[model samples]
Target: MTVEALLIWLIVGAVAGWLAGQIVKGHGFGLAGNIVVGIVGAFLAGWLLPGLGLGLSGIVGSIIYAALGAIILLLLIGLIKRA
Candidate 1:
């Protein structure tokens, strides 16, 4: 990826990961975990949202969607652990 793309991804990942942690009511993971979540969540979000006819555009949009996805995954994991 270009430097610009990488920078954008970093920014998006930071915001999205923190937001995901907040949504799931869990302590935010360290920077590395956040990066993993944010990047993976971006793809997950892109896959899932389309089923509902929702979409994200640009870095901000993608980050928002990705964050939501990461939150869902975190929440699900919490539920599974509690069971």
Candidate 2:
């Protein structure tokens, strides 16, 4: 991917991660960690959503999808940590 695409991904990841952290509560992972979480969340959503017959469009949609995935990721992490 081009630099522009990479930048967009990072931006999306940051925003999505922040959103997920807020939604999940007490899960702020800082900037870099948030970006990683968001990117992975985006990938997770990209894989899971399609199979579930959900489709989102545009940058906002991407953020929402990624945030959903990030929330799931955070919840799973929380469970793992508790176990």
Candidate 3:
């Protein structure tokens, strides 16, 4: 992808990660960590949502989609840690 696309992905990932951290609570992984989480979450959502017949569009949709994925990711991590 181009630099612009990469930058957009990073920004979306950061925002999604922050939102997920806030929603999930006690799962904040700082900026870099959040970006990673968000990007992974986006991928997770991209894979899962379409299968579920759910698809989001536009920047806001992207953020929401990624945030949802990030939330799930954090929850799984929490569960794994507890176990």
Evaluation by TM-score, superior candidate among 1 and 2 = 2
Error of 1 at 17 (Å): 0.7
Give me the runs in candidate 3 sitting further than 4 Å from their true place: none
Tens-digit lDDT track of model 1 for 1-83: 89998988887887888889866776778888888887777777878888999986887788899898788777778899999
Q: Distance from true position, residue 4, model 3, in Å?
A: 0.6
Pairs that clash in candidate 2: none
Error of 1 at 36 (Å): 1.0
TM-score of each predicted structure versus truth: 0.85, 0.93, 0.93
Residue-level lDDT tens digits of model 2 in 1-83: 99999999999999999999988976668999899999999998998889999899999999999999999888899899999
Q: Where does the lowest 10-residue lDDT sum fall in candidate 1?
A: 21-30
Pairs that collide in candidate 3 are none
Question: What digit string (tens of lDDT, one per residue) describes model 3 on residues 6-33?
Answer: 9999999999999999889855779998
Q: Model 1, residue 51: displacement in angstroms?
A: 1.0
